[model samples]
Target chain A: MRTALRLLGGQRFLVAPLCLLGAVIVFAASAPEFLTLGNVSNVGAQMWVLALLAVGQMFAIVTRGFDISVGAVAALSSTIAAHAVNALGPAGLLAGPLTGLLCGTLTGFLIGFLRLQPIVATLGMMIGVRGLALLVTGDGQVVPLHDADLASWLAFDPAFGLPPADWGAIGCILLAGALLGRAVLGRRLVMLGSNPDAAHLVGIDTARTQLRAYQLCGGFAGLAGVLVLLRAGTGLPTDGAGMELQSIAAALIGGTALSGGVARVFPVVLGAAFIQAVLTGLDLQGVSPFIAQIVVGLVIVAAGFLEFALRRFQGFAFHRRSWT
Target chain B: MTALALPLPVRSAWRRWRPGAAAWTTLGVFLLFAVLVPRFASSGNLVNVLRVAAILCVAACGQAIVLVLGGIEFSFGSSAALASVVGVLAVPWLGPAGGLAAGGAVVIAIGALNGALIAGFGLPPFVVTLGMLMAAAGAAASLVGGQPIDAPPSAAFAWPAAGSVATIPVPILLGAAAVTVLHALLSRSRLGRLWYLAGANPVAARLSGIAVGRVTFLGYLVAGAFCAVTAVVLTSRVGSGQPNLAPNLPFESIAACAIGGIPLAGGEGRAHQVVCGVLVIAMMNNAVVLLNFPIAAQQLVMAVVIIGAVLLQNAGSLPVMLRRALTRRPNA
Candidate 1:
């Protein structure tokens, strides 16, 4: 069992799956409706946005970075896209993606080229982008949307029994698997995260690789923004309010190292699903919402402990090496 | 030899202070705001800015120590909220002095717990403190049953925040006192030096026989105490325990420290960084209000400043700077 856990990339990676399984068992026993296919699809649909954000976050984490700004990116993109769609109709399809790309590029430049600390840099961007979002929306009111054909197609249109957004998330997950497991850029990013100095010495342009990682993160954030905006049927600036913490927690629980380098796409998606299940299960069980916050926080901390323990077991003396 | 020797004092002063890019930018912004903005240069407004900056300085000062030791605390704002709750609730039971003391102890204990988890278990400070931020915020919310706890208005209990000491506002005086004590701790105390060394190179510090774990643990304890001080001032000023008090403070405090030129990666920061950074933010916030710009603008500007300050402050040395200088080619 120990060797199996190690082979699956340590006990840390197993946490999200185990949590998901535990929630299923517990919730199925308590809430009879939880086992219903109808509720299962409902939970899956709800988890789509978080899963997308986690996938974006995974890219940054793989390169020894974190993008707290993704939430803001989502907010800004949705708001901006909402405005554009209101004015330009079908042409506004490009708005959300473009806005996300722009925000992602900016965050990329700060961390990759400018060498700013990822957390602080992205944090500043988070606040700044949110401010810009608020400024655009004016008076913090949610921008009401008129039902457009494009919006309906993307948001409400069922794609063989699921919304297009859910399909998008699944596609992104597959894309992430390909990117991290096979693509050269993804491989370079893992290398850079493993040891930036070594990667640089080996003729990799670390800055560009890191920049690409953030750009992808930002793009994914943008996609998430568009999907969420569609579902809500309006551009809510505060929509992504707690998402930054949620995505970070999901990434951590998914087994992405806070210290960076390891990135597995499927586990991250499962982690997001696991968190949603826990929250959904709690809600069904009539638990307080605040408990969800506490649980997310504790899970992240636990992930940290588990990661360190696993690393120690693997004979990686972190303090003696990189930290010092 | 004479000419080189002539610049020695000047060089030494710069090295000793090593005020990062943020300090210069603060001065530039001060001058700019004073010139372009109406009534910005007025004495009354400047004092008001300083007064506001004082509260931020309390938390930022504590955070600087953590940053210097290569850790970050996201819990200060939430901890302050919790402290405010504790202080206001305890005031009726324990009176003013005892209430503040009780509140102070809770905040300090929160910090110590964070320290023990981090230092003892080798857990990442980011995750540990992020968790604490969540738990603390939740606890504060749950304590008042999601309502703000109001303290009965009393002059004696509230004097530490509302009243002045020798013409200075109590909050301002308290802030100044905190800064002074922290400055002394960082510059004059052995523990401060140990913190710097540990932050710079923990393994080296451990090999050198420094108790890196204990020092780190204590550093967090001090940070917690500072958070309590800020909480007391906030609670007393408002005459209430506000669970929502200072929600944005953690980021703002960090931004202030960054503006003061504290490297986010840690190892080198000081009390002055907190002061300078807070002043800049205070001034900028004042500018937004005075200019009739939306509050959102202030956040946007702070965000830009954080990125700009970090970029300029940590861009490596002279030769590297010259290499990237606009008019030059890489191999030229």
Candidate 2:
């Protein structure tokens, strides 16, 4: 009974898995069309951008930092990709993702190397980068990608009849999970998140580890940019607004601690999918996207609260006592 | 108090430097900005910078108080927006001061809601205040009917923005006057010191018989009042109460605080430093605009500076942090 109570009381870092389950159930139960092949693929397609952002946010969140600039970077990447797609046709295929990766990497460098708080550093990036994205694109208009053959092959085509981007996202998830979970680099990254000071005491190079995690995160976001551009046939400067918030929400839900030290990247993917599912369900039910945004905000706050509450009940505080 | 148990250098330095570090950092940032930005040190530009920093300072200084107690007023954004709009809508009926008071009252009521949810019900500050952030934003929208409001022009409202004091912007004067009062409240009053005591360590404060709850309530109340002051300044500056005067305020104010060395971590930091942080940000913005740096380049620079400032500030502690991070046990 004590064990059960304790289990009940603690916030299990299963937010990602649970959110995935909840999203699937809620969408499948409420919207009959949601379970259909086209719709699930649609979900998958929508998730392409979010997944990349999830990886980006995962690194920052795990390090007890935030990269709110992910959204901004996404916009800039999308804008850049849009222009690159127009300029290079099929050959410019790699440009979009590369732009995003570079943007994410550069921003990450500032945060990790300069030691700025993730949120502020990213906030500045968020405001300034978006403007740059707009400036580059000449406005909010998306530059259409003319390479239908390439777009279909790279974005929509499926190796096993699944959307190509879905497979790509899966690849991303696996790669990220392997990097975070199994690699020596991954272990060091986790250690960096756990406690920079303590990691330093034992000769772990905190800065380099952090920089690598950020680099990986940026790369993932870049891939997400490619997927988004391919699917939409165009990229808008506003493509990734508020994406960082969603990614953070998904990561926190997926069971990653906001205070760093523990991470589970696969769970983060599910969390993202779950959140998208819930939003899709709400959209089917005639709820406005704005309302869904509010719902997403609520979910994040709830997830944060749960983590805080669960940690409290177990008599093992992972981080400082936050307003759970 | 735990430090009291320790002898010599540790306790005294903690009491002295920790309290004033934020202020020194703020000054340093201001000086840096004034030197770095072209025309940053110019008298005309300096006044403009001060004017820009003043309204935020009014809001942030109060935020500093609440943060000291570990309570965050995310509601400041919505409340300021709401106050500005409601005051505008009420001006025709209630006169200027009355309109201001009416807006102030609404803010206080909303703050009351926040206080009740947190203190009375024991809801976490994050949840309670986040809820307020949403609810207040919605309320502001409803009050304005999703449209901009046209406020009746009044000197009482305009005094803050008018560059009336012999080339010195009135907003700067207004901000200075407000800061004078806030500084006094924070430094001179027993209540203020007690507030810091409560923030530095709540359990210790409680053990010492301080009314922790009351302090928290008042701290939030003060936050609301300060938000009202900012609302007044902002609305008057635009000569109307635009519902979206500062949708990004919570982020901006917090960033200013972080950059100024008055992070939300609480206890330490001071108002004098807060003004400097605000000036630094304003100057940076002015410089970016003046230099005509492409937005991206400015972003890169801004990002670098922010991260650099934080790293520089904590460089001495890096070695200690590294040691701690390594020794912390892995998930067994």
Model 2, range A250-283, lDDT digits (tens) per residue?
7777777755767777677778888788777788
Task: For model 1, report the TM-score of its A chain.
Answer: 0.92
Question: What tens digits encode model 1's per-residue C-alpha lDDT throughout A1-324?
Answer: 878876777666787888789879989999999989988877888898899899899998878788888888998888887888888885674698788888888888777666677867898899899899989988578987786566667767787988776787688779878988898888898898888888888878777778788889888888788887888878878778778778888888898876668878878988899889888888878877677666767777777787678778878745422321
DockQ of candidate 1 compared with the true complex: 0.50
Q: Relative to the true structure, how large is the alpha-carbon lDDT of every model?
A: 0.82, 0.70
Q: Candidate 1's error at B149, in angstroms?
A: 3.1
Off by over 4 Å in 1: A1-7, A148-153, A317-324, B1-22, B314-332
Candidate 2 residues lying further than 4 Å off, grouped into runs, are A1-11, A14-41, A83-113, A131-135, A138-141, A157-161, A312-324, B1-45, B66-75, B82-170, B194-218, B239-243, B287-332
